[model samples]
Target: MGWLWDNAVTLATIVMAAAAVAALVYAHLSITENRAAERRANANELWRERS
Candidate 1:
């Protein structure tokens, strides 16, 4: 469509922004998961030492 062609750049920019946001969200979730796993490991180590 003529309107879509005229706004192609705008559409592309929006798509890129959305993708960047998604990447940031994924990275944050991964960091949180890693921290949780590290905490669990640390607790297990402490338990073993105590026992």
Candidate 2:
């Protein structure tokens, strides 16, 4: 791992940045899915109540 030793700090920073971006993407997608589920649930309840 000569390359890693040569650029340890930069490599670590890059890895951390990638992890941060991934986490943000995951969180955004999870929130979107949760909101969609909530909407579906509400719609079902409304239809059930009407019938």
Candidate 3:
């Protein structure tokens, strides 16, 4: 734990990088899920229109 205090800057930089990566991954997954939901809604609308 003393090493962490001694290398606080380095540790913080690593933590920030990890957080950025996690954010990007979460954003990508959200976008993908939203697109899938949009597609299903569109398909349902089209079917209703035809029926």
Candidate 4:
């Protein structure tokens, strides 16, 4: 476990990078879901106007 203590900085950097990637992915999914919901609402409004 002495090696782990010596490489703590490297391990922390990797963990930080993984967290950043996960945050980006979460943001992307949230944006996509919002866009899809907006499109559905728009389609419904258009259908109602046509009817």
Candidate 5:
């Protein structure tokens, strides 16, 4: 078990990789939300005309 505890560089690399993956996941969610909002606005405008 000491071998696993001895590699600081490997542990740092794994942490950085995990953070990068989390950032990508958040970005994907943001794009999806923005797209849905735009579609909802368009749909509302079409149905909102009083004339």
Candidate 6:
């Protein structure tokens, strides 16, 4: 379509921005999950030591 052709660059920019945002969200969630797992492991270790 003529309209799509005219706005091709704008569409591409929006797509790239969305992809970047998605990547950042995925990275943040992964880091949070890893931190939670680390805390759980530390707690377990402390419990074992006390027992």
- Assess every candidate by TM-score: 0.95, 0.94, 0.92, 0.90, 0.81, 0.94
Give the Cα lDDT of each candidate.
1.00, 0.98, 0.98, 1.00, 0.94, 1.00
- Candidate 2, residue 36: the lDDT equals 100
Tens-place lDDT digits, model 4, residues 1-51: 999999999999999999999999999999999999999999999999999
How good is model 2 by TM-score? Answer: 0.94
Q: Ten residues in a row with the worst lDDT in model 6?
A: 1-10
The sequence of per-residue lDDT tens digits that candidate 2 reaches over residues 1-51 is 898799999989999999999999999999999999999999999999999
- For residues 1-51, write the lDDT of model 3, one tens digit per residue: 899899999989999999999999999999999999999999999999999
After superposition, which runs of candidate 3 have C-alpha atoms over 4 Å from their true positions?
none
- The prediction achieving the highest TM-score against the true structure is 1
Cα lDDT tens digits, model 1, 1-51, are: 999999999999999999999999999999999999999999999999999
Return the clash pairs for model 3, or none.
Answer: none
**Candidate 6 on 1-51: residue-level lDDT in tens?**
999999999999999999999999999999999999999999999999999
Off-target runs (Cα >4 Å) in candidate 1 are none
Between prediction 2 and prediction 4, the one with superior TM-score is: 2
Of 5 and 6, the candidate ahead on lDDT is 6
**Is 4 or 5 the stronger prediction by lDDT?**
4
Off by over 4 Å in 5: 1-5
Q: Which segments of candidate 4 are over 4 A away from where they belong?
A: none
lDDT over C-alpha atoms for residue 30 of model 4: 100
Comparing 1 and 6 on TM-score, the stronger one: 1
lDDT of 1: 1.00
